[model samples]
Target: MNEKTVAGYCIRCNDQGYLTDLEQWNREIGLEIAEEENITMTDKHWEVIEYLQNQCKQGVAITIRKVGKSGVVDIKQFYQLFPNGPLKKASKIAGIPKPVSCI
Candidate 1:
């Protein structure tokens, strides 16, 4: 019999950190949340993150209004389309640093 080895993504670096990687300071629970629920990470996700990061660099929240500039829907729609919160799983896959708020 073989046991299943679960692999998870790190919330901080988005690297595949497994059970041996679990630590207290900056580890995110719900391993499945990090492992599954990853979108295809299309240009759309990139566009969204780029806009959000730019706005964040300016000390502003990336709102639907800003997302509108990309012709994308609100965060709610993003979640609906992506099936997970913006900064939790998808953002990690999209290659954006985990938002401080999400930590």
Candidate 2:
């Protein structure tokens, strides 16, 4: 496994930069990851991130369509929030494995 420092913490991660250990994640790490992805965290973004983390904890398969129906954000807004590769970016920031639905 690869390791990188984020928010002054060394975190294990995959080659794609998604954290390998969910337990090693925290708000500061998420913020750093989002910044690396060129995203500025907002309340709505935090809401969506929480939703994704909950879904991941429950072992639910996450997809764009599912997130659209999550009532957190619609598909268009999801794109607006994460731009290119929303699901992948969101999953990374959420400290979960990259969704298989993303390429």
- Overall lDDT per candidate, in order of appearance: 0.46, 0.94
The whole-model C-alpha lDDT of candidate 2 against the native structure comes to 0.94
lDDT of 2 by residue, 1-103 (tens): 8999999999999999999888999999999999999999999999999999999889899989999999999999999999999999999999999977346
- The CA lDDT at 21 in model 2 is 85
lDDT of 1 by residue, 1-103 (tens): 1223334333333243322222221212332444465545555655664555455556665444456555656667677656745544544433333445654
TM-score of each: 0.42, 0.94
Which residue runs does candidate 1 get wrong by more than 4 Å? 1-37, 63-70, 90-103
Q: What root-mean-square deviation over C-alphas does model 2 reach?
A: 1.8
Q: Which stretches of candidate 2 lie over 4 Å from their true place?
A: 101-103
Which 10 residues in a row give candidate 2 its minimum summed lDDT?
94-103
